[model samples]
Target: MSYELRDHTADVAVEATGDTLAALFAAVADGLTAASAESVPATGGDRFDVEVTAESREALLFDYLDRLIYERDVRLVLPADHRCAVVEPNEAAREGDSADPDAWRLAAGARGVPLDAVAAREIKAVTYSEMALERRGDGWYAYVVFDV
Candidate 1:
């Protein structure tokens, strides 16, 4: 997984690419955490599971990141390491004509330290502007904008 932070007028942006949807999500999550913390260690305090679902890929990403920010603000902690898995409909779903937007979901676990120790900028919220989630060749790529 790889990600880069881009400059935006009053917000911050993150563009990430991965071999799979889950990897891409993980990268973005890492980027979000990095934006709020200088260094996220591989091992830390406690662990928590986060689960989210949305209508589309882009919505799913927005919800996922927003969930992270919510957790940080409420629980006052940051993840040092995380693992995620995204379940999405395949070409097989087209054969069934299922339009259930709730079918797409992501499950993840974050491990880390309390928010008091980390030093970095705070992300206000996730934004839809300049957001993209698409398949590029054999991998997946995404661009997310944050209201910093």
Candidate 2:
């Protein structure tokens, strides 16, 4: 998996690729952490678990990043190392609940350090602007923009 930071007029965009959905999410999460800090410590000082459910893949990406932002603000930390898994809607569930809001779920673990311990920037929010998450061939790709 890999990610690159692209320059937008005033915000920053992250483009990531992976061989699987989980890897793509992890790459993007790392990109988010990179955007928030100049450098993250090799080892993190705080750790936490994250769970988010959404109506679609795009929405899942949005909520996952939004939750990290919320965690940073509440805990005064700069989020860093991360790992995540995406659970797609099963055939049975998709056939049964057309209006299910939790069709997509993400379970993740993350590590962070105190905001004061690093040179950090403030990310106002995660936006739908140009957001994308899709499968191509046998791999996954994602793009997301962050409000700085």
Work out the TM-score per prediction.
Answer: 0.88, 0.91
Per-candidate alpha-carbon RMSD to the true structure = 3.0, 2.7
- Candidate 1: C-alpha lDDT: 0.83
User: What TM-score number comes out for model 2?
Assistant: 0.91
RMSD of 2: 2.7
Candidate 1, which ten residues in sequence have the lowest lDDT sum? 89-98
Q: What is the C-alpha lDDT of each candidate?
A: 0.83, 0.88
lDDT string for model 1 (2-71, tens) is 8888888898889999999999999998888877776865556799999887778888899999998888
Q: Ten-residue segment with the worst summed lDDT in candidate 2?
A: 92-101
Query: Clash totals for all models, in order?
Result: 0, 0
Best by lDDT: 2
